[model samples]
Target: MNFDTNLILSIMPELARAFGVTMLTWVAGVIGAALLGFLVAVARRYGSRWLGYPLRLCVEVIRGTPFLIQLFLLYYGGPFIGLSLEPIPAGLLGLTVYGAAYFSEIFRAGFEAVPPGHVEAAECVGLNRRQIIQRILIPEMTMLVLPASVNMAIILLKETAVLSIITVPELTLVISAIGSQQYAFVESLFLLALFYWGLVELAGRLGRYMEARFSKYRFVTA
Candidate 1:
């Protein structure tokens, strides 16, 4: 069978709209997850056992469960308890919550990687708790975590496809719809892969740029 380049071009507009939705959700979800995960990591690191244990347990539970099930539970289960969420919001919330669990572990490890000597040195130099965390700990941890965080971003980007299961009309939903309607399953799937490939490539480049930017100071001082 011959591939129809024209058909692929013809669906670009629809796919573009769908891709926009996918990107928007990704941005919102990742931001929320990063913030929530950072908070959770900090709590686990600094809080007492009473607080830390529950946070750790929560992260473990979220990480252990399938993301699709979590999405379904949030969207479908919410209504039974009188919490009604619209499609996009529910999908974003699900992605954020799912991503947060993983990101928290990444952040926790990053925090742990900062040597106690560093914090002690900062304290010896009269840096307050906030000063030590802000000027010393966070910067070092960010550099260490950059690679893992980028990989997680790509994973989350692909996970956006699952949002289509609930009719969120993201890239995968649009591609599948066109494929089913036009009987061009192979072409549609190929385009889907292409889009994700482009996104992953772009994310990797951005991550590398950030890593370099963060490393510049260390290189200069050394």
Candidate 2:
């Protein structure tokens, strides 16, 4: 069978539109997850056991489940509970909740990586706990976490494919739809892979840039 370059070009507009949906959901996911995960991390660090234990449990549960099931549960289960959501919002929420679980762990790891000596030194300088965390630990931890956080973003972008199962009309959804129409499964799938390849490449480059700039502030002792 001959490959049709024209077919790929012909579907560019359609695919790009779908890709817009994918990128939008990705943006929603990253921002929502980062904020939510930040809260969860803070609670885990400073809240009472009652709050921290449940937050930990939530992280574990979300991490244990697949994103597809989470998407189905949100999209299909929302209507039954008297809350309705559009496909795009459902996709965004699902990816955000899913990403938040892992992000919490990633962030918590960064906090734990901060040395006890720094905290002690800050206290010796008359800084309170909040000051130690805010001024000393967080700034350095941000740099240490930058590389992992960037990698998480790449994973999140790729995982946007699962939203296709819920008919969210993302990149994979459009490719699948065109594949069904033209019976060009291989070609359509190839284009889909190319689209994802571009996203991941962009993410990787961003990660490298962040790592280079942020590494300057990383804590190191002689």
Candidate 3:
């Protein structure tokens, strides 16, 4: 069978629109996950046993289960518990929660990688906890975490494709629908793969650039 270049061209506009949704979802998810993950890491590291244990359990639970199941529970099962949400919001929440679990581990590892003497030295210099975290710990952790965080971001980006299962109108859903209606699965799937490949490639390049820019700080000690 002839490859349908025309069919691919015809769906470019729809693909572009869906691509925007995917990007928006991914960007928001990454930001939310990073911030929440940092907080979780900090709380688990410094909070009392009561708080740390629960947070640890939650993190383990989230990491152990599949994201698809978690998303289903949030979107489909939530209505039973009076937590109904639209598809997009549900997708965003699921993405954030799922990504946060992994990000927290990455952040925790980064924290551990920082020398304890650095924190002690900062404290000895009369820096309070917050100031120490902001000025010293964060800068040091950023260097350690950048590569792992970037890898997690890419994983979260790919996970957005699963959002279509909940009818989130992301790239996968739109392309699959087009393929079904037009009987052009080959063309549709090819375009979908191309878009994702391009996105992942761009993300990889950006990550490498950021890593190079930050390499000088990686070896800097307190």
Candidate 4:
């Protein structure tokens, strides 16, 4: 089939809509995963055996399994247990849960990297556990963990393409649909790659900007 530039232009609007859906899915999943991961990390570090052990097991299981399988289980297997969710929600839920396992590890490492002396100093200064964590530990961990967190965000962004499998009308799904309808498979795929490359590049630039700014802020404060 010939590569048709006009055909590509014709489908741009549809692709844009699908891209919006992809971004929405990524943003929701990443935000939810980050929060959940941080909590799990904290629990693993500080909670009791009853809470920590189960959280550890959960993180392990999620990290061990394939994301596609997890997405399928959530989208397809949920109804058997009386939990009904739409395609978008199911996709977001799977992404959040799966990404959390990996994010938890990154966060756990960040938490551990906090100097023990700092905690000791805070204690001697009459700071309570909450104050120590809030003021000293969290800020240090943010500086330590921001780069890894940005990498995880990119990973989650790529994973959003897999949601097409469950018919969530994301970019991949839109591309496939246009290809089938227009019989311009090559053109469709070319555009798909271009779009993803642009998005990945944008994410990388944004990550670098954030890291630089945060690093400068840390330096100034120091």
Candidate 5:
């Protein structure tokens, strides 16, 4: 098989353009995950068993099912429910829901890992539940949450591949379309592999830096 150098060069420009879209998906996915997961965790904590059970069930159901199915549900399944989501919206929604489930667990553990003394001290200082949660709990929980959040961000980055199925035009879809259109099969996929690897490497280094930074502010490294 003759490797077409010209084809690779042509595809590189398109891949580079699509790389921005890929990063957008990652950023949106993480934002969605963080907010959704935080809400779920809060609901579990404050909403008590009534609201908590359903949230837990939601997390379990999402985690149990494959993301491909969820993407289909958002992209293909929503129309039946009178929700017309575009491809990117569908993909974003699906990844958000999926990432939320994992992130909820991360958050729950993080909140739990908050030292009891912190909570008690906040109470003694006349902090109400809301105030204590906002100030004491969140700050204390960060020490625990930072590492897991770092992991979740990396996981979400990898999971962006699933968005391709919904035709979100993310990195995977971009490469797949290019490969099929141009038949620069090996080069296109190889470039994608390289792109994803580079992202993973960068994320690992950033995570280490974050760990060091956050660890400094952690209270007794509990």
Candidate 6:
């Protein structure tokens, strides 16, 4: 089949619009995930066994399940439970929940990596729990977890394509529909892959920049 450059050009405007939707969902999802995930990590690590056990189970269940299944349950099955949400909202919620599970794990690891002596020293210095967490724990953990967190963010971006299945009209859904209607599957798919590749590359570069900027905070042994 002939590659249709003109067809791709004609669809650029549509693709651009869909790209904006994709970015909006991704930014919202990542922000929500980061906040919720950090809270879960802190609670599971420091809270009572009753709270920790339940949160641990929740993280496990979410991580073990496929994101697509989770999305379906939220968007379709939610209405049965009187929790109906619009497509974009459902997509954002699913992405946040799914991404949070993974982010929490990353944070947990970062927390454990900090030496227990550090917390002890903070206590001896008369720093309260909140002060220690704000001044030391969070800054130190940020350096350790930034790489993994960035990777999770990229994964969340890619998963936005699945939102199309629920009629969110993200890049993948829009391009796929155009391809079907125009009978130009090759062009549509190629463009889709190209757009995703560019986004991933951009995300990777941003991650690296952040790592470099925060490198001084990372632990180093003498």
Candidate 3, 1-222: lDDT as tens digits: 557998888877888899999999999999999999999999998889999999999999999999999999999999999999999999999999999888999999998999988989899999998898899889999999999999999999999999999999999999999999998888888888988999999999999999999898775554
- Ranking of predictions according to lDDT: 6, 3, 1, 4, 2, 5
Better of 2 and 6 by lDDT: 6
By lDDT, is 4 or 6 better?
A: 6
Tens digit of per-residue lDDT, candidate 4, span 1-222: 688999988887898899999999999999999999999998889889999999999999999989999988888999999988999999989999999999899999998888888889899999997898799888888988999999999999999989999999999999988899878999989988988889889998999998988886452222
- Give stretches of model 5 more than 4 Å off: none
Per-model TM values vs. the true structure: 0.95, 0.95, 0.97, 0.96, 0.94, 0.97
* Residues 186-211, model 2: lDDT tens digits: 89888889889988999899889878
TM-score of candidate 6 versus the correct structure, residues matched by position:
0.97
Clashing pairs in 1: none
Each candidate structure's count of clashing pairs: 0, 0, 0, 0, 0, 0
The per-model lDDT (C-alpha) reads 0.91, 0.88, 0.93, 0.90, 0.85, 0.93
| Candidate 2: count of backbone clashes, pairs at least 3 residues apart or interchain | 0
RMSD of model 1, in Å? 1.9
- Candidate 4 Cα lDDT to native: 0.90
TM-score of 1: 0.95
Determine the backbone clash count of candidate 1.
0
lDDT of 5 by residue, 92-148 (tens): 777788999998999899888887888888889899999988987887787788878
